[model samples]
Target: MWRDSFRLQIFCLLMAVLAIVVLVHNFFQLEHMDDDTISGSNWITENNVQHSLSQTTKTTRKPYCSYKQQTLSKREQAEQESLLAAILWPKPPDGKIAFVESTDPAHSDFVIVKPVRFFKVGDELEVLVRMKDFQGKPKQYGGDYLQARIHSPLLKAGATGRIVDCHNGLYKVFFTLLWPGEVKVSVSLVHPSEAIQVLLRLREERPDRVYFKSSFKSGKYSETTECNVCLPGDLPVCNFTDLYTGEPWFCYKPRKLSCASRISHAKGGYQKGLLTQEESLFFQSDVNIKRPILSSGPDSVIVKSKAFT
Candidate 1:
């Protein structure tokens, strides 16, 4: 009976050891499987993160590339404009002209004529004419023909002025006074500048012609007027706004009359194409209404025409 009991205890101990071994092996296998699962999940998460980063990089770079393209396009456009300006710019004027002065061949903003009021017989006189644009801006381009004349209405004496082109918009007029009694100096354009004419033709819709104001001393002045170019026998009246200033002017002309006649000083009156420098200043000034001048001296009577040439 003692032997049998010892054999039974040994069997029980062996079975318990076998069960513990099985449990330990199962635990190690489970741990290894869990580690593999964790590693695979981490790899998948890393791949997802890398893909997201790639997508983000692509999205951000697209705008950068587009901006670079836009910058290049603008630079090219500016270069093209510069090239066109250099190529298409008009050349200066040169030719033989009678009773016209072309001095310096360079352009200026204002004309200076000295000793305008008082003069003696055989006294040499100088007159300067400046070329400017419609906006009262100095014109750098030159190619205009100018002519000058000095005559007295009361006297039989008259003199012709010599013009020297400065190659700019400026011209110098040289004349010797033949008579001293109330001599009138008049300058007219022998020929319009090709460049300026082309510009005017291109901007034909605009009224760029300069006109003198009638009764400027009486505080009554008009600068611009509009004319219609309709079919024959149509209404002659028209209204238009100035392109540069947006100021409104009105005029009327019958089919029998020229369109130029529409720019008369007063209604149904003849118009003159002379704008004095002082009167031009009045136009260029910031003042809205035409202000009356206190005519105190002969300077008020000295008329200087301001033309584009």
Candidate 2:
């Protein structure tokens, strides 16, 4: 019995020793795992802090915009006022003036007239005049009626007349000045009394070009005055006293003035006594300026004449 009890005590002591060894090993493993978790948590926190700092640095470097009050300078305000004045000013009733472009040799391209606007004393004014027809076609007239006139006190008195264009239609006249000053301009049309009036204040840097159109509704009639000029079946001829020369003149045989006749008349005076022979005058019966024969038909001739002064 004593020997059995001693064996049992020895077995119990060996089991206790094994249990203590296992418990020590487990405790060491648990400690190592805890250290790894702490390291991982520290790494994650460092990465989050670095990312937040990068975002903050980028935001600080970016540009920022905000609404602000705006204002104009004095010079800018003055310029705006000048432009507004020009826009609000009344335009000439007769339209604008333009240069005539024509191929006819008898017509003068530019009329010699005073500057359209007169600058202050000792100041030279430059004016540009352009003539355009009713159809808006450029450079069409080549005649004496279309011309430019400049009115000023220091310049020559009375209006200067010159042939500018022969084109039939509304004419546009443009005027400009080089210097600065207030000037009164009287725009006149030849033969036609209706003209345009314009008043302007010219400045050195603020040059202006004013516009006016000529009266197309006036001019002397070329046909007969007493009777209505009609072309029922054939062209009719008419005769009357020449307004300028008080001489007996005849529009040629075709009754209607030919292009050749117009060209001839525009070239100053034609040879008057060319047909002195008796036979020549007799043969030229159709060339005589006489009263036209009237037709009772519905197609009656209408006479167009200018109003006498």
Candidate 3:
């Protein structure tokens, strides 16, 4: 009975040793496959990345956070302030809104109200602009961004005109006749008020809409990944900031290459879906943006020389 008991004890010890070996083997296998798993997974979201802290002794990893933003990081706070700044920024519009992102430059018109038979260089010229929509309906409120200038191609002279918004869709442009002979007026809608709002949102929320990339090389091995001024989430990043100028830069960590291996950088591409469908309507190339308003009556006025005054 004693010999049988001793043999059973020896067998139990061997089984325990075998169990430990299997556990250690499985652990290393998981570690080996970790990078491949992360890379193959769709781990990124609109504003965050879902990734656990990688196991590495050479690099720092953020503590796993099940709850995001319990305490705002400096980046989070800065993002909040940027969004707040958009609301606090000063702008013109002490009136109501006629439409939302509907200013059509093609349907808009400007006219020379007081056309004089003869004008001298010392005189001031005035022009009236009326804002309209694609349907040709008059805009009742102000706040459309405009650029106005008076230029004489023959005289090779040009000057910007001062614009005054009446808070009602009408804008008055005043130009001082400086070396003018056949001075022509031009008015362009740089952006509609609602489109400006969309821009402000993009500035506050998705400043990294235009992304970039970088390449890392170690011996014959190379890896490339996207980069930006700042990246989202707790995913690992390589800091490439300029210490002397205090300029900050960062890039997404490569799967195989270390941060120290980064050698080259270049533009990636514009991030998709930065704007909503409604907001995208404001930025069509052939639409209202940077389009010129037609002259209703006369686009040019002749001015006499100062000596002729």
Question: How far off is residue 96 in model 1, in Å?
Answer: 22
Instruction: Score every model by TM-score.
Output: 0.30, 0.18, 0.62
List, residue by residue over 1-309, the lDDT tens digit for candidate 3: 999999999999999999999999999976765534433123232233221132212222253322223466698789878988765532434322334427889889999988988789879999999998777887766768899999988768899999988867799999998885788999999998667777777876776888877666566445667776657777787766555543446677887777876666666778787877777777776786898998989899888888884
- Evaluate model 1: give its lDDT: 0.42
* TM-score: the better of candidates 1 and 2: 1
| Pairs with steric clashes in candidate 3 | none
In order, what lDDT does every prediction score? 0.42, 0.29, 0.73
Alpha-carbon RMSD of each model? 32.0, 40.7, 10.7
In model 2, the Cα lDDT at residue 279 comes to 21
Worst 10-residue lDDT window for candidate 3 reads 49-58
Selected candidate, larger TM-score, 1 vs 3: 3
Angstrom error at residue 86, model 1: 28
If both were scored by lDDT, which would come out higher, candidate 1 or candidate 3?
3
